[model samples]
Target: MHVPDGFINAPVSAVAGVVAAGAVAVSLRGARKELGGASRSAASGGERTAPLAGLVAAFIFAVQMLNFPVGAGTSGHLLGGALAAILVGPYTGVLCISVVLLMQGILFADGGLTALGVNITVMGVVTTVVAYVLFRGLTGILPRTRRSATVSAFIAALVSVPAAACAFTLIYAVGGTTDIPIGKVLTAMVGVHVLIGIGEAVITALTVGAVIAVRPDLVHGARSLAVPLKLRIDGELVDAPVAAPAPVAARSTRTVWSVGLVTAFVLAGFVSFYASASPDGLEKVAADKGIDAKAEEHAAADSPLADYGVRDVTDTRLSGGLAGVIGVGATVAVGSGVFWVVRRRRQDEPADARVTETV
Candidate 1:
């Protein structure tokens, strides 16, 4: 949940800011390796794959708008960090979550502008790293079976949401303005989020499992486990297709792009109307424990896009729907453009001198 300004003290928020910045810095470097890795599947497209990455980000943003109920009056939205990291690469996933949080804070005024750093740290960095690590560990330790991947996805996502909640609690313990008991805060935050985590696990597992079924090659987390393209010589392993990887045809890219964009539009524009209107886990806890007493109103609350509605749309549903659609479009366009540029820039780099010389 987008922790608003008054929820966490300035010191805690600042620390989160630093943590978030550091994580982004690390991801920038890691992204190079993740994106540059070799692939065996015919779908292991390179630079042209950037548009798909963008679609993942946009889809995450759109689905996040549909907040599912946890229990009681509290609800939880799709953090999407784990889902993205599994679907796309971890670095790109971090970038994707950051973009969504930025839009939410600045455009929708949903999350506090001042607390943007904290949200990014707790929701983006913590979730992505935790999920990715768990996914990898499980994939390695368990049998290399399809069921293992789905099971791993479930556990990784289940753990990540509460881990984020615990992180927030720790931050609050350090910089909490009020004298609330740390134990109570921790217990409450973790307890509520555990339920939320179930929802997270189901959603992440379903979404990731779906992609892995269709295009496991497209899934960054699942890339290393890709089925090797071996020669069928008497049912024995042979030299895999290791040289000059096949290029991604333009027609395939167009198909993926179109389908993804359409899915994002439908989810955000129409499905969001039915999202739970109840308070989220954090909001419910804040009210129950008096943590919200010092909460400050967001400065951008007056913006036209604030609260997910256009400025002058007469119908509430129409306004919110349009805003959601526009948000999806904008997020997709920006994310895709940024990723395309990054992929292209990397493409332009000379192939590794050592590898080239060897070849």
Candidate 2:
């Protein structure tokens, strides 16, 4: 959920800002390892995989716009933490959601600028940590099959939503500016979010399953589960011809990136029009429980693209679609740029330093 301004007082918000900053720093360092896995070296087992992480971020931004109905007068959308961590690494997943949140706050004014820390800590750190840990644990215990990874994604995503809700409730219990009882807020938040988690789980499972079917190599969580390329002849097994050459493998990464980017554009630009119009879980909860009593207007509320619509565009559909498309483009660009820097820094590090640093 996107916490708005004034929901938390200055002191707690500042603390959250420090926590968010620390998380971003840690994630940046960790993302370097995962992005480096995409190095051009054939021995690395991947090529330009960093770009795929950008696509994941853009895809998450696109899907977050499609709010599905979770209950009477309430809707929910993809938080993307579980999906991202499954597709990329958990650190990169954190960065992906951070990029999306930053975009929404500054450009769309959907989340308040002042509450960026709260939003990131709740939606980015908590969700990614919880989902990734659970996913890894489940994948470890379950059969080493593709289905297991997808199943893990579903369960991880389902749990992450309410976990984030619990996190937010705890944050509010300490920093809330309203008179509402903490028990009521926690119960309502967790109750509605449980339904929302189902939607999150379905989207995560389907998306992870589709990617695993097409290109399991691109899925970070499924890397260990990839079946060996083997062929049996004369009762002996050898490497199969299924493995592509290095050049072809590099080209495949580009192809996948191109296809994913196009899909994100389509989802954000066109399919988003069909999203539920009802208020999302957070908004509904805030309104019903007086959490918004002291909520201040967003700093960027006057932006031309505020509220997910273009300022001068006449048609509502056209305006919103354009905004969504713009958001996807910006997210891809920024996310790619961030990943590129992380990858380059990783590559440039002295071998001794790299070796000396603990992962």
Candidate 3:
């Protein structure tokens, strides 16, 4: 959930800012390894991974626009932590959600400027960390099949939403600006979020399964599950003969990237118009429990894209559609840029090490 300004006291918000900053810094370092590929020979994997990471970010942003109804005047959207962490790696997943949150806060005014740290800490860091841990643990114990990976993705996603809700409750218990009782807020937050988690699980499972079916190689979480051929020699199983490396085909990510970008465009530009207008899980809980009593106005509320609408666009459909498109474009561009920079840094580190050795 995007915490607005004034929901948490200034001191607590500042502390959250520091925590968010530190988390982001750590993720940046970890992403180098994740995106750079596990082996030096596959340094080119960065070439394949970087663009896909950007597309994932854009897709998350687009899907978030389509708020599906949960129940009782509450709706929920894809948090993208599970989806991203499963598709990419956890480090990159954190950055993906952080990018989406930053874009929403600064461009759409969906989240507050002062509360950016809180939103990032809860939605990006907490969800990504929890989902990745559970996904890894489940996949470890389950069969190493694509189906198992997909199932793990589902369960991880289901748990991550409630985990984030609980995290927020704890944060509010310590820093909430309102007089609401902690118990009431905790109960309401966790109860409704459980429903939201189901929606998250379904969406995550479907998306992860689709990707696994198409290009399992691209799914970071499924990589370890990929099985190699084996042979029975002398009544004992042994590793199969290693095939010589074939001539490298001119691999192109254009087709997959195009398809993903088009899908995001359709979801945000067309389908979002039909999404439920009800308050999301966090919003509903806050409204009901008086947790939003001290919520302040977003700094960018007067911006053109504030509230997901274009300024001076009288047609609600057109205004929202344009804003959504813009959001997708902005997210893709920024995400790609950031990922590319990280990838480049990864590429450079080896060279710097070599130079040091020479010296």
TM for every model, in the order presented, reads 0.89, 0.93, 0.95
The residue pairs that clash in candidate 1, if any, are none
Worst 10 residues of 3 by lDDT: 37-46
Inter-residue clash pairs, candidate 3: none
RMSD of 1: 3.5
The true-structure Cα RMSD of candidate 2 reads 2.8
In every candidate, how many clashes are there? 0, 0, 0
Q: Which candidate achieves the best TM-score against the true structure?
A: 3
Deviating ranges (above 4 Å) for candidate 1 = 37-45, 227-248, 350-359
Which residue pairs clash within candidate 2?
none
Better of 1 and 3 by TM-score: 3
For 269-292, candidate 1 gives per-residue lDDT tens digits of 999999999999888888888888
Against the true structure, candidate 1 reaches a TM-score of 0.89
Ranking according to TM-score, highest score first = 3, 2, 1
The TM-score of predicted model 2 comes to 0.93
What are the runs in model 2 whose C-alpha is more than 4 Å off?
37-46, 227-248
What is residue 67's positional error in candidate 3, in angstroms? Answer: 0.5
RMSD of each: 3.5, 2.8, 2.6
Query: Which candidate comes out best when scored by lDDT?
Result: 2
